[model samples]
Target: MGLPLLMLASGSAALAAPAAAANDETCRPTIESPWVRAAPPGAKSLAAYLVLRNGCGTAVEVVDVESLDFGTPMIHRTVEEGGVSRMRPAGKLVLAPGESLRFEPGGLHLMLMQPLRPLAEGDVARVRLVLADGRRLFAQFPVRRSAP
Candidate 1:
């Protein structure tokens, strides 16, 4: 296979931390507990969950998400309205500085589509987290039957 084309945006690299630490230059974000659910064969897509935090100083905008194993990867969130629930595209979420956002079932998540191969337990999926500043962060999501 060839190298994947990076879909990066020149939106001023971490020019301003979106949610909390807009001015904190000392801010370094982190991704924790990243995991993807095990799917049956022939499954078209999968949902990955994790915790994103920007503790201390500064802010960052997660511009986009991409994966080599999947053709399409998008950040989305589950919303409840009028007693009904649905999934919608979460366009550039901003987390308050010193705050942590949880992406779990029935909440914010990464939708990985068009899997290159079926991922099962013990397998891992690697994804790129693009920040607004044109910087990129790599995350490895282990496949699991359920949240650990």
Candidate 2:
């Protein structure tokens, strides 16, 4: 009985060790040069752009995004269909090993709609991004008057 119990405990610990390591040293994705596109007065919707660089050995995917400034901050991509450009939810943004993804106009971006309050220059918006492995990356995106 004692031998079996010891073996069981050892096996359980072995299984949990990797999971703990994965959580401890997971990928870190940084958002750089984050800015919101300048919107016209009375406009209810805006878009934010940034560059996401993965600084980890393993690849990571951005599965979700959230912000209090917008009704719903969603990952979006612009596509041209039938000579009309439309923006649609990206659902998820995946990055390969040591890869960087850029979000800008006519490309992947954040759709910020129905601003709770007016978003003006110098207003830094707090944003949260959830990775596929349940890790949350945060960034304070500065509200700018134009896209750079």
Clashes of each: 5, 0
Worst 10 residues of 2 by lDDT: 20-29
**Can you tell me which runs of candidate 2 are displaced by over 4 Å?**
1-11
Put down candidate 2 lDDT per residue, 1-148, tens digits, no spaces: 9999999999999999987877774448788888887677677888899999987777788998888777878889999999999998886678987899999989899888788778777777778888888888788888888765
Backbone clashes (count) for model 2: 0
Question: Between which residue pairs do clashes occur in model 1?
Answer: 13-133, 14-133, 17-59, 20-97, 24-58
Q: TM-score of each candidate?
A: 0.78, 0.85
Against the reference, the lDDT scores of all candidates come to 0.83, 0.84
lDDT of 1 by residue, 29-130 (tens): 889999999989889999999998878455567878999999999999999999999889987777667888888999999999999987989999998878
